[model samples]
Target chain A: AQSVAQPEDQVNVAEGNPLTVKCTYSVSGNPYLFWYVQYPNRGLQFLLKYITGDNLVKGSYGFEAEFNKSQTSFHLKKPSALVSDSALYFCAVRDIYRGSTLGRLYFGRGTQLTVWP
Target chain B: DVKVTQSSRYLVKRTGEKVFLECVQDMDHENMFWYRQDPGLGLRLIYFSYDVKMKEKGDIPEGYSVSREKKERFSLILESASTNQTSMYLCASSPPGYNSYEQYFGPGTRLTVT
Candidate 1:
């Protein structure tokens, strides 16, 4: 079975400062990781994904994530946080070997990110 | 822009009543999914359909059912609405064969069971 863990329930950061939200996963085969952000009363928006090849992946809204194989982690990062960046963040993972149709993702509990001015 | 639209943004229903949540995507994607979002639980998949009339049970499918009569439409059904089933429901669609293809989401429908 595949699973994801977000160690932090909430993260606070000053605007213009770098922000990091930690995520870790456990899977039997190669992992397909994804990050999504959700605003209050809205649906989740895709941030980025890590399939293969690159360890560092850049995403929309000046966000990025680093995939660490040994650590079994994929932490979301933003060099300069904005106050509007405050939202709920989710980390998800799936087993690539299980085939595409079976691409059911295991998601984390979610991290509430609050960017202060 | 590709649009995924849910039929309602908010709904209130009585317990034991039958409810239906509809979703439509204009991108003609091959895969559509239904998920319920609760505080601290993130999104839990209820069901998904890869093709018309073909559906599969997701991680959490109890008390919920789905319909896919057309490629662009997917509907979630609650046979008997319960208070515990009240939550924000999200619909998503994705293309086939693309391992990295991202899932596009609808605005979501918040359902309240009395």
Candidate 2:
């Protein structure tokens, strides 16, 4: 089964400092990885996805994630943290090989990121 | 902009009551899904329908059921609402034949079972 794990329950970072939210995935064949963010009382917003190509993929709100196949990880990163960036982050994996499971996303437990001033 | 809309933003119900949460998408999407979000747990898929009259169970589909009679509408039903069923229910839709498989989500319905 395809799955992803977000080890940290919460990550705290100071404003102007770089921040990272860790994610590791396991899938059959090649993986389709994704990162999504959810603000207070809002549905999740897609941050980025790693379908193919570059190891490092840029996403919305100046965020980027590196798809490290060797490490089985796709960690979200930002050069600088902002107070508004604080939210819940989720990592998901999907099986591209068709059948009944097509387009179904298996999500991680989620990590709450807090950026302090 | 692609739009996915839900029936209610918030709903309160008593235990054992029947409940329905509806979702409609305007982008002619062929896929619609139902997910429940809880603290710590990001989003758990409950049910998904790829087209009218076809449904598939997700990782957690117990105590929940879904209907997709129309192309654009999907409905989630809780036969007997329980306290454990209280959660933020989300609906999503995705266009078919897209390489990215990017899904558009609705704002969600917060359901509270008393």
Candidate 3:
């Protein structure tokens, strides 16, 4: 089974400060990780993904995530936080079910981020 | 731009009523998925279709069914709407092979069962 965990239910950060929303996962074989952001009443927007190679992956809206195989973690990061950055964040892992061609994703519970001015 | 549109943004229904949630994607992707979003559950897959008339059960498929008569359209059906089944439903489509790693999502439909 493949699953992602977001320990924090909510994270608060000041404007211009670096922020991180932690995520950890468990999966068989190589892991494929992704991050997405959702604003109120809107669908989730893809942020970034980590398949292989470089540990750091940059994504939309000045956001990035570090994929650590040893730690089984893919934590979302941003150097500067803005008030508008407040939204819901989700971490997901790709699961290619054995004997199946279609790919499936397992997502974490989600993290509510609040960036204050 | 890859556009995935749902039939409605919000809906209200009575228990035991049959409901249909439609999703159409213009990207011509080979895979389409349905998921329910709850506050603490994040997103749980309900069903997915990789080709016309071909569907697969997902992590949570009880009380729900799916249809894919055409390449670009995927529909979710609730045989009997229950209060506990009320949720925000999301539809997504992804290309085949390598690019399938990412999925494009629709605006989502919020369903309320009373």
What are the chain A TM-scores of the candidates, in order? 0.94, 0.96, 0.97
RMSD of 2: 1.3
| Local accuracy of candidate 2 as per-residue lDDT tens digits, B1-114 | 889999999999999999999999999988889999998887999998888999988879999999999999999999999999999999998776546467788999999999
Candidate number with greatest TM-score: 3
TM-score of each: 0.96, 0.96, 0.98
lDDT of 3 by residue, B50-88 (tens): 889998899899999999999999999999999999999
Cα RMSD (Å) between model 3 and the true structure?
0.9
For candidate 1, lDDT tens digit of each residue in A1-117? 889999999999999999999999998878889999999988889999998998999999999999999999999999999999999999998653245544666789999999998
- After TM-score superposition, the amount by which residue A90's alpha carbon in candidate 1 deviates from its true location, in angstroms, is 0.7
The DockQ figures for the candidates are: 0.63, 0.59, 0.79
What's the C-alpha lDDT at position B96 in model 2? 68
Order the candidates by TM-score, highest first — what do you get?
3, 2, 1
- Model 3, A4-116: lDDT tens per residue? 99999999999999999999999988999999999999998999999989999999999999998889999999999999999999999998855666688899999999999
Q: Is the docking of candidate 1 incorrect, acceptable, medium or high quality?
A: medium
DockQ of 1: 0.63
Question: 1 or 3, which is superior by lDDT?
Answer: 3
lDDT of each: 0.91, 0.91, 0.94
| Deviating ranges (above 4 Å) for candidate 2 | A96-101, B98-100
Kindly report the fnat of each predicted structure, to 2 decimals. 0.54, 0.48, 0.75
Evaluated with lDDT, which candidate comes out highest? 3
lDDT of 2 by residue, A26-111 (tens): 99888999999988887778889999999999999999999999999999999999999999999999764256445778899999
